[model samples]
Target chain A: MSLDIFKERGTPLDRQSFTWKDMVGEPYSKLDDDAFTRVRQILMHGVEQESCRFKHFAARFNPELRLPLARIRRVEHHQATMVNWLMPGDQSTLETTIGFEQVAIEVTAHVAAVEPDPYMAQIYRFGLLEDFDHLYRYAALMDRLCGKDANNILQSYTDVMPGRPTSVEHRAPEDDLRLHYQKTRAAPLTKIHAALITGSEWQTRDYYLTVGPTFADPIARQLYAEIASIEEQHVTQYEALSDPSETWLEKWLVQEATEVYAYWSCYSQEQNPRIKLIWERFLSYELEHLRLVRELMQKLENRDPAELLPAEFPDPLSFTSHRKFVRETLAAEVDLRARGYDIVPMDQDSPASIAYRAQLNAGGSPSEAVAAGYHWRPGTELTDRRVRDAAFAPLSGQEAAQ
Target chain B: MNKNDRPTDIGINRTGIALSPLDGPLTAEGASAAPPSSAGSWQDAAMVRLRYAAEASEFGHMPPPATLRGLAKTAKELLKGHKANVLLDKLGERLAFERTGVRLYDGLIVKFEANGSWEGGPTLEELVAFRSDEARHFELMVQALVKLGADPTAMTPSADITAVESLGVLQVISDPRTGLAHALHAQQIAELADVAGWDLLASLSETLGHTELAAECRRALAQENLHAAAVARWLKAHAEVAARGELEQAVAS
Candidate 1:
């Protein structure tokens, strides 16, 4: 049966009717493989959607509204936590960490390809490499800690090779704000893409923030802390692409609509019965959220909610192997750095040079340190030299520097 | 189009009221006064229409207003019943596993297509279907994570296991030196292990009060069992082919 998200509003359970006991969802161990994948997609979409939604509200000039918006974000965060903890008991933390990097790699690559704005696409590619490097770094840890190869978790789909070495990923925060898109002229997909990516990067930052402290290995903890900082920069770079001129109400409407669109997309594509039901249910919930935002817009500004968004869904975001796209991008753009909207080749002497100095000043980069630790103990470096060499071949003098 | 007609009068019939004057000569003084009718150009008119068309296109992509109202009502009810369930570690593992599954299938598809048809073995169509199923599994796992309000990108232990296991298969598939036989052997091994893993997960989920999840595992287990069996059959058939060729060579000698 065709499920119409617009018409199918779910009945939200009453607060008094349910206790804290009801808040705890059924913790399942084995989801059907298809079902589990759907769940992950929906959750990833929600995490990004909610974060973008919260950011829009939080950016409002009105101080009085901040508290309410923050509360909403907190609830969303609670929801995100629930979605995150659905991992089976058999999986390890290191294994999951690899999964996170894979998401960053694959999802970023997917978004980059479809991203309408060239500037935004550039940023996606730039971060794609660092995350690629991160996968290698963490894979090394997986090997050291568990005596397992990184390829096992990656399923050998993503190459466990360096992109742009994470050692050079550091840059001045001032350089982070490269360029912004004009909101009025930008495509709806562009806005959603920015929001989606910003949300994903922000969540990654937060994940590292919480998980970094729990690591017993000093180097591992340091690695988390270091990578987390890069995520922070990634968040900065991606969020900068958002049009700051957008009104909070407009952003809110877009967020709700995006959530609906994402859920609907998942529901449409879902083959598994149980997961499809969840997608339908959530699509209904998000539709309700969109309705409330529309009302607030009508009441507050008397503006039509229809004006803010389009009548049909934009292109759906699909997570697939971007191995070829990523490899090509790595070959071409590995040595480039963002200077405002323009991506220029890296030049240590150029006035625009911020990353090189930033890297040198940050002391011994934890990224390199992790690699060194692996080398010192295991008698091998983290990445496959062949893959690493090929990816960096375009960068002149990179071999000597390494 | 008479010269006497105001520039604004030209396209006024086609495009409603002109926001800016359509036609006038520009002088330094005129820049401040009515902008010297810069808006009267056909280019300007076309741009205006284009903007309208863009806005119209935007509307096409959005959900209808009625749907929004329905969603808002549902959201209000949900807010009242909102409660958080914390299951941090397990969700992390599941997310990792599904993510790995996606990459695994992706690599396999690439390998299968690049290698072309396996001699007297499973067709590319069959491989594509298997890859699609893996993609579907990845999507379901992602949805489950989202429903629970968790971040699927977070690092977890199970992901490490998935990465390591998938890596072995990837190594065989990605290397040019390895052929379909090696790939099939790798697939058989992977599928067998997958079935065992799913079986264990299914029982564990049942014990943990996740009957739905257990059922899901059983479904995956069934698929894995088929996959393993197919690979085994293909391997046997290939071996027979080799044996027959060797026998013919001996007879000729």
Candidate 2:
């Protein structure tokens, strides 16, 4: 169930086609499908988006690449549609957001565990805990505001407890920047991980910005604003990990390789037969994308694609729960703070970040207010005997009169 | 030439004050003062949409029956050369609405707890009972659908559409900013829909010759009618208190 990225001739770029009906086929069952199915969906959509985004930029600057990039970008566009439309309309924005954070937690956890670069792995671990905290905040919102269980989406695969507090995750932009992996020295898996995560966070930030205003709830709106800001910080932090010296063709080649690897991973682990076929079809389509990009790189840049991409992808991403690893990371690294390319202790936290966080919190933290006194219960905190009885009982004065 | 369909035809429509000799010229002058921001066919936007709309698939289809019993029932109905599936479809729709209705009540109850009830508003106990009734009604639908060999949990076409229709009210009720009165106003919307849903289900069941299910739906409809009436009264109380400028005093009292 491994894929050879350098060898597989997936559906040729000319053959990558979709009708609107095929693009928006039946969605997975919200109630019955595995949560990991959704994890795969959100991640693949983000991966395709980043490829499309990068190709467009490359087209702008590199005159020779416009037509090839346009052809590839069109397929990437339809591929993104087919993947994202698997999310049914029935899942609310907040509930789909729950699925988004699950992708963030588990996928980042998988990469962090396997990344060979110690510095890059630390970056993944740090981002992992922040997303884990987001799941907790949103789970509380879902329970308190929506009166629905987030575990219904989470399926108990990921924990619903806090990680590093999101209110404190706000840092100065400079502090958010991290050291780049050397293009010559970084593992193939490291480059793919950076692109995958940066793209996923970018889409998340954009999704929140787009949908945040549609909410009439003031706190939910503020919560989306606050969280989307952190996602922006994440985009800054993770995108900086890729070496700046890599040429546009070099970057494009790696982007296609990342898509190929991600779809391959999804195809291997997909449980739903229908969605699995989508993953299968898209996997071949990406392989062809990788083949075309690799050929273009060789022709235009005179660099062998074999020299850049691995003959075989590193192990497919682990789609299983990382609850133990996540909890252990929270226990160990939750206190780690950023200080200009370095994760450090609170005593070593950058002064600029402290001042920045202070100004932001002066207005009151929506993350804190939304989760104040919030404890995750099986159903909700309202199900707790003390809270339930008190909540359902008479008002204080009314009780006194009674 | 067809005036309406002609893109640039200067039709004589008096929607504006162009007919008024006094202010019409002034208003028309103000309208023409600001140039359009950019010039392109608005058709550019509409054409892309038109193509997609022409090419789009449906929202979804009814899932095939999960069990042989269900498949046989569906097949028998189809063979009967009748619309037996229609009854089960509407039943599933009712089932989904009642299930979400239970959660909607739960969200409203949380709103009540944080922002306490006003004078002549719902008691904590009454809201709890409302939630209970929703739960029971949804379960009743589940039983009824199963007895008819339908999947109670499937999002029927009508079920999916009902969720879309009710999404706005759910958002309002779930908002932490909304007060008890605001939540009751939203609850009244749900109650209104619930009463109609039950009424239709009862009549549909009777027409389909399910007398027992019809009677049960009638009972649920009665509960929904009471809910609608009570919710309307509570909203009026809150509205009147605001009108009297005694909302703070009434709530405190």
Candidate 3:
């Protein structure tokens, strides 16, 4: 559906309410449903999460927009709950961690492929490789820690291989920032991508911070710490990608339009009928939300919301696997490193980053420890019957005793 | 810091209302005096549960047979009374349980190292031996599933639920703050459940006429009972030491 954000009057904010039963509805199946279903759910949950977070922060700053912001934020809180609670209880923390990484890898690939600006696309691909490497590391953790195949969670949708070595992805704080888009000249989609991806990484960083300590394994704990740091860096880069010069209302306007785009994307491609209806219903709710925010923008600052939104939304973010694009990106840019808003060859990495990473790795890296000589076998290391990753091979009673 | 401080040495654990004195009694009185928020019984929640339960789908389905020989075995079993997947799914449950069971012991082993054991509690060798048994049993379950033409790697619905249940067992054992006895208490819970699981699994196997598999399950069951007994003895001994002699000193503020 070609949705003109400015023209479509979405479901009224008053009607966007939810019941206790409705908000805590049935979760999507981890086994039966497509992996991309979880992807859409996780990303959109992040999107709504950001919506609530942005409004809270915006309310602290904008005294005039506070009430409408809270009105929209209230609906958004329910929206976040509805989306996040859709993850089935059966998916373990590590298993769900795999799903989160899949979102990063796949969604970033799509954004990178479609992002028009060369530098922005390069940044997306660079971050893409780092997250790609994360899936491989977490896949290793799932195998080495639990003896389960990551593919079971993956359902063969996303590949489990290193893109950029996560061990090397760490950098000094300054290197993590990127050049923001020229807000006036940048495509509306560019602003949308920045908001969406930044929201995703922000939620991811917070998730890892929350769940990291729940793990008992020092390896799992440290891997989360390590990767969550990169997620922080990701939030930094993606958040910086947006021009900071835009007004509070302008940013808020863009946020609402992005939600319209995201829900449209999910509604367009969702396969499960029950979940599809949610995306469809929420799409209407978000349309109304966009309208509410647009009205607020007009009244509060007399700004034209149309200037922030495109006449038509860009192509709905593709929810399909970009295995080919990912592999191609890996081959072409595995050695690329971030050096203060510039993507460069590994040899050109900033010395400050090298020093920072060296101090962090002085003790030894958990990502390397968990995946030592590890490969993604179809069945986990345990299932290979002929030869197992001897590191995890079963010990006889006497051997264990010794 | 008390040089003689032990995990079981009770300090200021102010959880119970008796410790809270005035506020605790007042809180209890207030709760009893409070009117109901809504006009309904507990069945209100039950009805909600029932509605959701009726609407809910199966946690998951069994995958197709990975091998033709096992497929033939499953087909033959289907010619009789029971569904083949039922047996396969239970076996998969045990496979997952035993796999996680190994990790539980791995965590306990680290606990054994970090906080040394008591007079009657576990030894390093005992922890290692138990872990080995779990690993070997996991291997046995995997082979049994393969023999039944089921893919061992695929998590059956039962396997998924069992993993969900193990999460709590895992949490207790993995927690460093938990005492060695506390960790054993957690494992003993698994052991009790493991004993029942193996017994039921064996009986099911026999009823289904899988005699060889039943025999192997009985062997694992016998081993599980031993583990449970050993854990019980150790816990009892550790508790008796605290309760009999040092009981006052342990609790004294």
Candidate 4:
């Protein structure tokens, strides 16, 4: 398939077909030989043997998008109410200001550990950019209203922002890096949860494209499909480093379903009038996105949409959370590996080392051939028995797929 | 003047005008046990000391102003002694939220999806929450200063003016008519307008640095000042009027 053939044949359907070529780029070549080997192995003995079925869920507006939008709204409205309250008292503007230091620290940290891929980094930057704009806008608004530059005074805290990216590894073991990040008595649970949801979204974007072709809404389908394809690229990039066995499709499904539920559950308790309005609007949007994805999955399976709902995710919130869950998952990686599942990285190490170790352990023997499959220069035998046991055990393709 | 000798027409504006100047740093106990101040008007002695915290914040000891060097210094400062840790630990929660405003401000200004809304802002409610946090700090500081006896009756004299000298730059750009004090005065009027019912002006006296100068007194003084300025302008006009009086009539003839 040369460029001319694609140019001539390129309708939406043609584009859909072109996605695989675009993604893998003329498969069965060295460019994807390693990925192909891993994918095929997982697809055949791993996924195909499993009775994993996707059911149809009807297309509906997405509900999860509301969470972020509503949160933005709530923060805004609260500022106004606070201003009105202050007018009589001659008090300085209070409500319009947000905690800048925390946000800066979070952004700085995120940018630092940020997987170092262009696309992923770009999207993350976009999100951070939006968040940054929100912070400054709030500051300016406060300054204008208060007649004093309270925003500048308030933002003075960022002056204390860590000048350097201090990783957990770089800091002395006795030194608490958490304090360096912030003096927060505790991480605000809401922010922690939001971060987790974001991580899940990051993971899902890649996974969703595997089944993007079958959607009914041209706009929704096309947008998601486009995003999904980009996401697949991201997943591949990540896969080269960690959790090589998990298909992009499985990761998307898990992330999407989990995120939808997480956002819905958290925002469910919103009582503020502004928060309630935005939450409802956002919830509707996410629900629709969820429904569209589920229905597409079901259509692909040739099943009733009602049956597809379960496959789409009857309970999406199961994956709700942020780094705490990631931390938990990391901590339990060894135990999970021992249970014969190809797992996420156990600690903060180069993805190459982690992937090589996991792959070697899965081969069941410390042979140079298996290590070679990991793309490692030969001779690193599996000294860790735990890794060996988890690697060689009878692993399910579905387990690998997820 | 004796209470009765003060004219009743002036209303309660005369009530605390003669009260001695408020004075002092807050008691050590109060400083140590400072309450988590609400996001509003200056209220008590403890809040006044928080002004120093705010001042320190301005110099880059805290968030937005923080640089790597500043943060390292702050960390070092915070680690100076067991007592310093106590101060940092106690204030850290509020401080974290304070920094959140810095980060969130970025979101509110530039990237908000203004789509058909006023200025494409976050709803009023969100803004209020953010503002309230800031207001609490300001109010706490003001109250603390008043509690410590910074004069509410008048801007502190020129020597004391140095305390407010940093704020003098504000005078250059702001209108003198509705300068900081008048702006504060207007804010009080607006707050009390609906609640001329709350007698909140009086309630706020000790807290507002108004123990000797209530809102009514401020408004009265503002009126007197305006009257005096008007009279001076009128006198100048009369001088011209008298001089031109005969000439004007002659011209008309």
Model 3: residues >4 Å from true position, as ranges? A389-402, B1-253
Query: What Cα-based lDDT does every candidate model obtain?
Result: 0.58, 0.80, 0.81, 0.28
* B1-253 per-residue lDDT for model 1 (tens digits): 1111111122312111122132111111121221111112112222323334545532112111112233345333332321212232444444555555556556666655554423355666777677666666566556654544455665545555556667667666554434465677777766776677668767765665556767887887787788778778866765664455542232122
What would the per-residue lDDT of candidate 2 be over residues B1-253, giving only the tens digit for each residue?
A: 2111122225443222223354334323432342222232222223333344566788777767545454455344542323566777788889989999999989988877776666777888988998899999999999877766667878898999899889878877875545777777778888999999999999987877678889999999999998898899888887766666666666665
> For candidate 4, what TM-score does chain B get against the true chain B?
0.19
Docking class of 3: incorrect
Q: Quote each prediction's TM-score.
A: 0.52, 0.64, 0.63, 0.22
Model 4 docking category = incorrect
lDDT of 2 by residue, A91-165 (tens): 789999999999999999999999999999999999999998888788777876777777677766777767788
**Two-chain DockQ for each candidate model:** 0.01, 0.01, 0.01, 0.01
On lDDT, the stronger of 1 and 3 is: 3
- Over 4 Å off in model 1, which ranges? A1-49, A52-78, A269-272, A348-363, A372-402, B1-253
Q: Which candidate leads the pack in lDDT?
A: 3
Rank by TM-score, descending?
A: 2, 3, 1, 4
How should the candidates be ordered by lDDT, best one leading?
3, 2, 1, 4
Q: How does model 2 score on DockQ?
A: 0.01
Candidate 3's residue-wise lDDT over B25-103, tens digit each? 4433432342322232222223333444556776578786555553665546543434677888889999999999999
What lDDT score goes with residue A77 in model 2?
97
What TM value does the first chain of each candidate achieve? Answer: 0.79, 0.96, 0.96, 0.26
